[model samples]
Target chain A: MSDLKNLRGKAACVGAATTGCGEAPGRNSTELMAEAVIHALADANIPLHEVDGVFAATAVHSMAAMSLAEYLGVHPKYSSGSNIGGSSFLAHALDAAMALEAGLIDVAVIAYGSNQRTAGGFKSISEPMPFEAQYEPRNPITAYALATSRYMHDFGATRDQIAEVAVAARAWAGLNPEAFTRDPLTVEEVLAARMISDPLGKLDCCLVTDGAAAVVMTRAERAKDGPQKPVYLLGAAMAHDHRMISEMPDLTATSAADGGPRAFAMAGYGPNDMDTVQLYDAFTINTILFLEDLGFCAKGEGKDFVGGGRIAPGGALPVNTNGGGLSCVHPGMYGLFVMIEAIRQARGTCGDRQVDGAKLCLAHGNGGVLSSQVTTIWGTEETL
Target chain B: MSGYFDGPGPEAEFRQFLADGKFMIQRSKGSGIHVFHPRVMVPCSGETDLEWVEASGEGTVYAATCTRRRPEKGGDYNVSLIDLAEGPRMMARVVGIEPDQVMVGMKVRARIDDLNGAPAILFEPA
Candidate 1:
């Protein structure tokens, strides 16, 4: 939550795009980021010269905001590099909105790009080489697995329940032609898949591919001149709970618990008001925690909430409608794509997977093994 | 490494304790908070008055997972978080048992082992 409450300056996401998603071998991170920025500008029908604020994050790029600005040849008055983790994009989105609300900038570009699949598999050393590396907590996978193990021990959540998240994501992927893995998926198949880390099979983990996504944000009045109807930002919240998995205060809880309520209160909305949802799914364990902490279900009921086509197509709550990192395109950091998908759904631009006359959407991004959480709510003009 | 790492600055004494085959944690005199990772600051209260104390090294396995990267690669091992007796948790691998046998809440103790050609910490069922 920010000090700038009851923001009078209305902000809308006027444009968004994804580029070099999937296995794009030749496209480097720089090229992919540039492509996404250009595509996003075109989608907004705003010239590149109009962008006065820039925000960028990438696993492979340092000082990403400055690098992207140099590459795109666009100067900016406000710039920031929020490399919190996969959730950095959501953090950037919130930062952009806060800056816009404060009259710091008029137009902001939030961007991300990565070449994890094509350049190098997701086998690189930890960014700072997790301090506990010598003690051997196999990264993100095992670190997250520990939490899943504790969840089962505490709440009786089963492996099949966790696999259900993968099945739902894959089913949604089958609807989008741009999704990387669209083939049919099942619980048994997910359980049988190779185990990368205990309690998490290959299917339970997100895809490793080349991808980039970007969004253009401007005050609602400035967005009136854009190409498509603006998707207004109703509320946003970001929190950093911990950096290392061992330092997490509660094994099953994350910063999502802190950000979820604040964002909802900011918008005066609740879980039942959501027409659709898009949550970061770096690991199925993350979805379960978000499902519970985001108040989609009672605590410890996330395992049941996601099972038996609960989040799949035609379900009561359609989540990860554009496939998601699990089945769609998860380059390295995946938060930006959630914003892109949320914006698409808010604008009624999602082709076949669109929620029927959807008016409100919730997108949550988790970073650093559920350490950092950034939650944002979007709404069409009708809902506003 | 970047400048100004506020959490824990080069815990040289912690490493020295490790060299002597002893497990150590920081006990903040100001607040009596036991800090793992040899950090100087107390999490419960922002106090830097710390004293290094040898830990009991006995802990309960809060969580565990078997990490395997390939079918034919090196044998899988169990990574776990141990809730030490001092009320601090640590990241360490559980040894002397099959990777899948390390159960949560099981009793465990720390032992020094050579990892990546350097002395490091590991856990075994107590």
Candidate 2:
């Protein structure tokens, strides 16, 4: 779509920053967005007046991009608030890149902020699913538990293997001061946590914390004028199979299969070439499911691939080095933070959690019960 | 499309049928493919030639989970995705057994039951 190969390295993310995460008392989402946008623009050494495009998606505002621009007092020529789920930010990044490459906008700022933890967490605003509403399943968690059950039934993935994901994320979180939870997590502790749904415990779910993140993008030439080294957009792709989990053709698989291949093809790279990975880990099963679907391992091999401390800190393959949503700040929409962490790692700015010699990194975002999957490949100037 | 526009919507019709003690689903008249969560068009073929047909009321559990709730809050219940013998999957609860005992691959049969004071389709071991 839209000649992904031609768009390779045409636009780059010059600045990435996050506002104070975990707990921001008495602050609204718009304030968080404004602060993050200001910080990110300062990181890029660009004035707010130079931002001609705004992109954002949030649960608080229906017209999130417009609200962000108005709050920040900028007149934008281009904007999008398309909410496809948590992966909306990565999708917005692709949209911004297209607009920048087309000369429609010279500077684009994509951001998201949520105070879900300060407010009530996880509201029930789902439209009636007439055909399948009677079952009384817990909206998202039960759906994930259902998938975990099927994966276990089909591939013999054990609870311990799934627990390894949480353990590894906690290990990474211990290195990041911004993480919401940094205590050492063990497999037994995860299994012993209160059961929210069958095959999934409280520890299996992601954190509910107030946070905001933003990224600034510009044309390849303009990025060279920025203060920070540009994290080039090598490839980006997004796809979705079903809106509801029951409608999914296969619970163990996700649309990452389609998007991952296309993104890698556009970048002329493969999974093996990546130095680190950042998967949207809303649930423990998600990491395993994505690992398999994204070509990191064969079908049904994700459980074993993450075993024996493979994905943990200082492991063979560093994944979710910023602790991921499980331990990091997950303020409902987490895709922006996922993309930001990958950018930070690729820039070698992550002091304690950075992967050594990480020239190339991959960030994958998921939304709506594995509904939307967007895979974006990023690299430093050396790789380009 | 043919039958849905006659009276109430497809969803209302399905619920009324269930209330009348008949469990039904939609079938694409041309392709014979079944669909669940009643919709306007055949999702795969985009054909509007749809008609109401009684389901077999027999299905196999494709996946299942026991959602835990406190004892004062209705205790625990099982949520299951059942593969109907007619080829459509739907979400329901597996009854007549412990919530945690509803296993994947178990054969189940649908029956009319009460859900939040409304008629619902619940499943039991076949």
Question: DockQ, per-model, please?
Answer: 0.69, 0.84
Q: Candidate 1: misplaced stretches above 4 Å?
A: A1-4, A123-126, A129-131, B1-10, B69-73
The lDDT of model 1 is 0.85
Top TM-score hit = 2
CA RMSD per model (angstroms): 3.0, 1.6
Q: What would the per-residue lDDT of candidate 1 be over residues A1-384, giving only the tens digit for each residue?
A: 544347422788998999888987877888888899899999988888888899987776768999999998888889998788888888887888889988999889999888879877874334544447775666777778889999999999999988999999999999998999999998899999998888888898889999888999998888778888888888888888688888898889887888888888877788899999899999898888998899999889999999979899999999999999999988878999987898898898888898888888999998877788998899888767
lDDT (Cα, tens digit) per residue for candidate 1, span B1-126: 633344445477778777888777878776777888776466757776778888888899998898885557667878888899989888888999998899999999888887778778788899
Question: What digit string (tens of lDDT, one per residue) describes model 2 on residues A1-384?
Answer: 466598888899999999869988788889998899999999999999999999999877889999999999999889999988899999999999999999999999999988778876764345756566677767778889999999999999999999999999999999999999999999999999999998999999999899999999999888888889899999999999888788988999899999999999989899999999999999999999998999999999999999899999888889999999999889888999999988999889999988998989999999888899999999888877
Candidate 2 per-residue lDDT, tens place, B1-126, comes to 535457677778888999899999999988899888788889867888888999999999999999999999899999999999999888898999999999999999999989889888899999
Candidate 1, clashing residue pairs? none
How good is the docking of model 1, as DockQ? Answer: 0.69
